[model samples]
Target chain A: MESNRTESRENRYLNPYLGGVLLGLVVIAAFYTSGRGPGATGALKGLIVTGVEAVVPEAAASSGFVAEYREPLPGHPLRSWLVFQMMGLITGGFLSGAFAGRLKFRIEHNYRITSERRLLMALGGGILFGFGSQLGRGCTSGAALSGMSVLSLGGFITMVSIFGTAFALAWFFRKNWI
Target chain B: MGPLVIYEVISENINLLTAFIIGTAFGWVLESSGFSSSRKLAGVFYGYDMVVLKVFFTAAVTGMLGLLFMSLFGWIDLSLVYVNPTFLTSAIAGGVVMGAGFIMGGFCPGTSFSAAAIGKIDAMVFIVGLFIGIGLFGAGYSIWQELYLAADMGHLKISDSLGMSDGLFALLLILAASAIFYFAEMVERKFASHRL
Candidate 1:
């Protein structure tokens, strides 16, 4: 019972509105220097290309993930800026969670399902999302959120597709979340 | 004279440093925004909370307007800013797949990291699954290669396609976002109490 109370309070995070403003500032900073925005999938892209290169160098070079990712001259794909940025995301998030004393390891789910079922959905869902991120050129953060901010048409379209489909599919997945 | 690397304002090596700072801020804001929680994120879909919508639209609009102003101020050249490359068919297909992933996994790449920071087991699993997802894509690039490379639209921005001025296009987006913000607020009031 005590644990349940803590869990519910933990669900309450920072104000969403303030979060938006800060997020916008971050996008602004991203654009000012790199002339682009933050992306979620590129790190994964780098890993994919690097993984394949490790396994089959020639084929990996020919693949889109590698071809698009190859550094111009002497640079390596694994030495990517996005990968580092992703690292920072993990670090920053951890630091903030630490400060808030909200760190814990547990599966979050509705009362309706067993933790095992929820984990299963998470794995299956992750596979599909990963596949989609590659196909879509980005996941929600990189393609949808950052892209839309810059008024990229593809960004707008992908944003709609991601959220739209989630709404459509959410009902089937409802037990896991709600 | 800017976009330093492109216009010779900065060296190639140093630009990577900028990418690091940008990422730090990006991660910081995402965590602070309540995006780190899957329950809150899913709330937007359920109409119990609109933080996702509110924050998403606000940030998008803010960035959009900032881009316009920067261009106006000549602080940055609009032409130099990267417009995400378009491969329409695959982009949509990828999005649809990711959407299902969103509802199921309960976190996207960026947000998953945020949740993990807070020690959520589900988020960690989701991320482990994300690596597999990307790895699988790399290993099986053969299957989706055609669709991925097909509809070559060559980095087009919607404003250019619509024949609208950049400022005008941005204004329209702002108006649309504002409308959504209003409605989202109402939806939150009606549904938020039911949320965890």
Candidate 2:
């Protein structure tokens, strides 16, 4: 009975169009002030570079790959603007969940799949996404969405490719999601 | 008179703070839109729900229009806004891999963070995997350097490349988006019974 009530509350999310409007406004504000789009993967990348530097200073410094991240101009790599923004994302997400009574600790998977399978797939997916974001110079939010907003041709291409590839492979991963 | 940061109206410190504020709104909107739910996100593929399409295109078009009006009014310098460079090869290749990941993981980096915020264990695992993958990429950067840098066309805009006015492109985009929204609604209604 208690679970059902929580589920009901979870269903009370904002209308998709309204949510999109709010999100777009945020992007606009970001462009107007920061002169850049909001980013997620960049923060994660910074953290990874910082972690490597902390554990093996020589390895991090020796690599021409991590050279830019070795010392982010203004301050510590971990203290980059994206890092703080990500922190705020966590905070805001939690607040929204809490307010909407949607905060639940559970694994979400289709009934056809086991929790274990779901987790493994998630891990594999994350790795692919991480690697791909680095290659593409951004992920969905950063490169594609933000890029498209500014009429960037690359952004449109990335957006189409991402969705096109997903659609092509959706059937194969049907069990995992649906 | 706009893009306040570019005009030096706000200090860098304050700009960073504003980033946090903007991110808060971004996260809040995403979560409230049900993006934190993997099933919902993946629903776009199966046609059970097209929330992702609806929200994404709506948001993109809205932002695009906002920038257009802002620039027309001379409130913001559109050129000053950063554009992701056109790296043709890597863009397509990376998008392909990310698409596969999207299907398997059911959450993109941003959405996963939101899911993790709500104590989703799968999202947490995905986050850990992201760190590891990035670490590996850093280690193997030499192998990827060439492919990553292939076909760099610099900051090219779609409107410019297609030889159409920006205003015309935006109008076409709005029409396309509206059509997608209409189709999405119809698909959802038809497939509402299908489980995802």
Candidate 3:
């Protein structure tokens, strides 16, 4: 009974449309002030570049992919706009979780799957997403959301492709999710 | 006049500060909307929950309309905003991979960060994989360079490609979104019993 109450409480969330409007306003705010949309993969890429540069400066300097981020900028890669935004994202997420009493160290997965299997799947998925984000030049947020806001054809294409592929493959992965 | 940073109305430091503030808002909204839960996120693919569809489409339409109105009011110059460039082969290929990732992982990059912040161990592991994946890409740049840079169609706009005014496209999009929302609601009700 105690667990049931907590489960119900945790399930409570903002209305979908309201959440979307707030998210939209935030997107508009990002563009209005910075002339760029919010991004997650870009920030992660910065972190990756920073890590690579710190461990092997020469490798970073020599590699074409890594070198692009090493522009003769005065500040560290972590000090860039996206990185700062990402930090705030963590902070904000934490705050929201705390307020909702949902902050807990746990592995979320379906009852049908073991925690170990879920974690493995998560890691594999992350690798694919990370690699794909680079190839596509952006992730869902940067390429799709931001792109669609500007009516960019690339954004629409990416959006359609991502959703289409996911839908088509959903049946195969039903065990993992359903 | 807007996009204050682009017009030099705001300094660089201020812009970074703005990014943090905007990100905070984004995170808050996402978490409050239940995006921090992998199970909830995955439900969209299974027709169990339509929150993702509703939230995503609404947000896109809202942002599109906001930009159009802002431009109409002369509050901002739309041209100054960054439009994602099209690399046909890479975009399609990358998206397909990401789609598979979404099915397996149940969270996108942004959503994963929020989930991790909320103390989801799976999310943390996923992030580690992301770093490794990105590292692999950087290390093998030569192998993927050809495909990544291929078929570059510079900053094309959907409206221009369709030969319609931005306003007209926006209107059609709004209509399409409404229809989708209605369908989503029906599906959600049908699958209510399957919800986790």
TM-score of each: 0.93, 0.97, 0.97
Q: What is the C-alpha lDDT profile of model 1 across A49-98, one tens digit per residue?
A: 76777889888667766666675423677677688788878878877777
Task: Please give the lDDT score at residue A12 for candidate 2.
Answer: 80
Segments in model 1 whose C-alpha atoms lie over 4 Å from true places: A1-12, A62-64, A71-74, B7-10
Worst 10 residues of 1 chain B by lDDT: B1-10
Model 2 docking tier (incorrect/acceptable/medium/high): high
How many clashes would you count in candidate 1? 1
Q: DockQ winner between 1 and 2, please give it.
A: 2
What DockQ values do the models have? 0.69, 0.81, 0.85
lDDT of 2 by residue, B1-196 (tens): 6678889999888988988988898888888899888999999999998999999999999999999999999999998889889999999998998898898899899999999998889999888878877777788999998998899999999999999999999999999999999999999999989844
Q: Which residue segments of model 2 deviate by more than 4 Å?
A: A1-3, A70-74
lDDT of candidate model 2 versus the reference: 0.88
**Per-prediction tally of clashes:** 1, 0, 0
Candidate achieving higher TM-score, 1 or 2: 2
Q: For each of the candidates, what fraction of the native contacts does it recover?
A: 0.70, 0.76, 0.80
Highest TM-score among the candidates is held by which one? 3
Clashing residue pairs in candidate 3 are none
Tens digits of per-residue lDDT for model 3, A1-178: 9999888888889999999999899889999998988888888888888888889988888888876666634478877878878888888888898888899999999989999999999999899888888888788888988899999898899888888888999999899888
Fnat of candidate 2 is: 0.76
